[model samples]
Target: MQFENSREFARQLDKEDKLSKYRNEFILPKVNGKDVIYFVGNSLGLQPKTAQRYVDEIMKDWAELAVEGHFYAEKSWWDYHERFSEKLARVVGANPAEVTVMNTLTVNLHLLMVSFYRPSGKRYKIICEEKAFPSDQYMISSQVRFHGYDPKDAIVEIKKRDGENNFRTEDVLAKIEEVGEECALVLIGGVNYYTGQVFDMATITKAGHDAGAFVGWDLAHAAGNIELKLSEWNVDFAAWCSYKYMNSGPGNASGCFINKKYHNKKDIPRFEGWWGHNKERRFLMEPEFQPEPTADAWQISNAPILAMAPYLASLEMFDEVGMPALIEKRNKIVAYLEYVLHEIDKDVESSFEIITPADQDKRGTQLSVFLHGEGKELFRYLMDQGVITDWREPNVIRLAPAPFYCSFEDMYEFGQILKEGILNKQKV
Candidate 1:
């Protein structure tokens, strides 16, 4: 438990880390004419250094093959999407047949909801966290209205009382019961964007099933940030973006999941396109839709091979290091951050509250700090001083030390910058 400065601590951790070599694979950005601490991996991840090479391969094939690239490339573009399924399936703890890499995040959400949210007369409620991301709220509300139902009454959000910042499992279970027969779908973030709180996906999925409802998750911030078992959890469906902890670059292609149990369930309708048509007869130019019996059936159009190559390389990195080791270092790094944040004077604690859960098991790699007096001002100060992080509207500063590249030393060094920014300088 004894460590010196952030540098010493990081060196010690690096020496013991089996996955330390993985950092060499990504491109890290510098700030303020100096190398800055990047704790915002929960927002946008650093690019994989190999990403350019991966894309260049496809570019070379495209340049040489032209129209023939579909079947003639080094890796056939027609079946290139298939390459990622096996590795991506492993990251989410799903069978290879149940995962597919496709579409941007919100687009996938709407598509998955089309199949999951089959609202009827009296059963049209959607259960989600009260502070769910704005995009999700829009999607849910719009979906409810699309079904001739008012979102005001149909969308049920779970919340905690005043003076409380975290939601309890029992409370969520109780709410699901209270809304039982009426609830049609349950959607929650695997790890909430603002709070960095990891919800109990398996438990929530069970509760949703007991109530005869579909369960889905938005793993934008959680996908590669934590270990997930969506298939084993029996989650009806799930979707995630890869730009964050996956180091796939900004606006990279996303991934989706459809339980193996529902792969052949034609009754669960999906928005159809030729890409999703049955693989055996994909190029036959048939009018009838023949969906594949796995998550591939959910695909709409051809995925951008170049955009997805980064994810391919990143997922391979995950397989190389494994999740347990990353999670082990992640917990220690985050705990150090919490310890450093708490070491600040009580007066500062009274002003800047750590909204993210403190328990190692309840959260992942990030912490959301809520500033009372002047959050924006402090944010600007930190930015000017080369301390990089993200800000959520109203008052939260989110800092996430990504496990792949972030070290404990970076966390401790930033802690010093935070103290100076908040305590030594005051413009408000």
Candidate 2:
């Protein structure tokens, strides 16, 4: 599909998009009654129409049932959390019993770390990428320090090649090999938030398993953006939030996956709460803390049913448009964005660098573009102009065009604004 400019290409792609109608299903943010091209779904997705209704039903349940909502409600609110499990499991490619919906991203990360990051006297180290989300860094450091281990000795962060912005798989495996004997776990984000690098999960999991380390993925970025085969890849555990690509609203409830391999094990050890006690006898007021034989054993407390309603709505939308279709749309949209951005003249080469990988297989919907000059100025300009995007530290702007609601035209608009911003900045 050759085209003279990005707008034409976008129009052509939209004309052929099978899920094009899904765009009108979202309540996109508007500027002066016009929908600003939204290219930040990687940070916060556009709201789905069904989301409000979903939450509203729960609100009605809360009003009608009050305290009785737990035991007796229209859908049995006590077990509402279970209503979401099968869909969450299928999305991550894990058995239903191996997955459960739970708390926020960082909370789930900490819970999983408690069960997975058990370091011995000699093998007391954890491996993660350099510049991981600050929360992950803090969690790892605090966990290491709490376990009476030195943070310097207990944490290994893989870096990119001397001047590169991404890590090489070979370099990563070599680092794993070097620390294998002393490594307790390897925790990696399935897709790096800053570089938008979709990692080779199968190979990484294989290497980590061979090294006798527990492997887990923080799929906060990769959850709905990519096709995950966590179980097939033999990934031991995984966690993700629903607010990003899942369109579950801000700070939606999170989900977890524990490989079924550990499901029937009694001594595998987890942080237990009464809500995780065997379902049949949960309300007996007994002192026993017997846990269910599945990932439900990892539940710390009853999930926020109200908070989870929007996620349920979003998951249903996912089921409507299967992952394969969404991935197809996302791949084209991002590639189009990259192509158009790269087409900008080289006169402003010093003004920015696209930190995301050139290959589609290596990225999701988000592209992290580093402004060589003043990143904040460009970011502010785009925001004030009503283009909603996100910014990370130093000087990088992230634009994630989610497949469910974001159109190719949005990408084209973003490209034009970005180029004009660069050109305008150069004049000053």
Candidate 3:
């Protein structure tokens, strides 16, 4: 697959792309009256064109039926969250009963930790990647403190080797084995936010279990971007935000997967709410809390229908296309993006180092590049020229060309814009 750095080549590839038509489904943003090349879908996905209609339907129901809309609307408000169970299950590779949509990503992770992160004396340590997303860091440390343990002692972070940007699976496995009897849980982000590295979740999950520990993943960047098999991997629990890569709106509701073996356990520790109670007797307000025999047992409140409406709208698109088709396009587009970056690097005075893994299976839609001899000014130039990418600390720029809306032309054009920005910097 030789990629060329020309508009004609890009357009030809687009002409042959089967998923290119799906780009029209999203409402891309504009810059200077033209569509911007959006590469921040790993941060906030573009709004699906159908999202407005989904919300409008809910708004109409509320206005027309008031409280009765819970039971009477075409998509009833009371059971709205249930709409995601099957669709989300397919997306995350789990049984319908093992998945549910609920609170935001970190909130769901905290709730899930209650049931899975049971830290007993001498076995209270948690293993996670070094420099995880800040929200996860806070969640894990706070959870440890809540149980009267110091984070310094209770949390073990797996560090990347010197001069390396990604964690090796062998190193992570060795750390888990080293922690051994003291490790209570192995929780890591499925796709790293900074480097776009995809961890070997199945092998890590097995190693954690073999060492007598629970394993889980925060799929904030992996949910729709990578293939996940939570049930097949025997993950104890997992959670992910729908906003990133799922094409849901900003800070939308999240999805969760809890293995079936933990479904009906009466002694399982979790914060309960009426929404999690058996649907048959929920309104009856029974004295005892009989949990739903599914992942819904972890629900702490009723569905946030307004927030979830956009998510359901996005899921409809995912259902139509399916993960396999999405992955197929993702691999090609990301490779083209990488190719365009390298080709541009060859011409520019500035050097660009891609920190993401070269293997498609070990990475997703994102390509984090270290722009040597460049700074925020170059990033601003790209943004001003209608390229919407993300910048992390230091000099790394994260470009996630979401396959749904991003095209090969976007990659080629971005390379031109980037090269121009670097060359212009040299003139000054």
Clash pairs for candidate 2: 351-372
Q: TM-score of each candidate? A: 0.95, 0.95, 0.99
- The reply for model 3, stretches above 4 Å from the true place, is none
lDDT of each: 0.84, 0.85, 0.94
Question: Which structure is stronger by TM-score: 1 or 3?
Answer: 3
lDDT of 2 by residue, 1-428 (tens): 45445577688889999999999889988876778778777777888898888888778878988988787777677788888778877788878888899899989998988889988878889999998888889988999999999899889999898999888999889999999789899998999988899989999999998999999999989998998988899999999988889988898888899888877665766788877888899889788677788888888787788888888888988877888898898888888877777776454655457999888889988889887667688888888777888888888888888888888887778778777887887787
Query: Model 2 segments beyond 4 Å from truth?
Result: 346-352
Largest lDDT belongs to which candidate?
A: 3
Write candidate 1's Cα lDDT for 1-428 as tens digits. Answer: 75444557766866786666766676767776766778889889988887888888889998999869889988888878899888888788899999998988988999999999998877889999997888898988888898888889999999976888888889899999999999999999888888899998889899999999999999998888788998889998999999998888799888998888888766777898889889889989899888888889899898788888888877878887777888888888788778777765353534668988878888999999887776577888788777788988898889898888876666677777777777765533
TM-score of model number 3: 0.99
Candidate 3: tens digits of C-alpha lDDT, residues 1-428: 98899999999999988899989999988999999999999999999999999999999999999999999999998889999989999999999999999989999999999988999978999999999999999999999999999999999999999999999999999999999999999999999999999999999999999999999999999999999999999999999999999987888898999999999988999999999999889999998999999999888799999999999999999999999999999999999999999899999888999999999989999999999888898889999999999999799999999989999898899989988888888878
RMSD of 1: 2.0
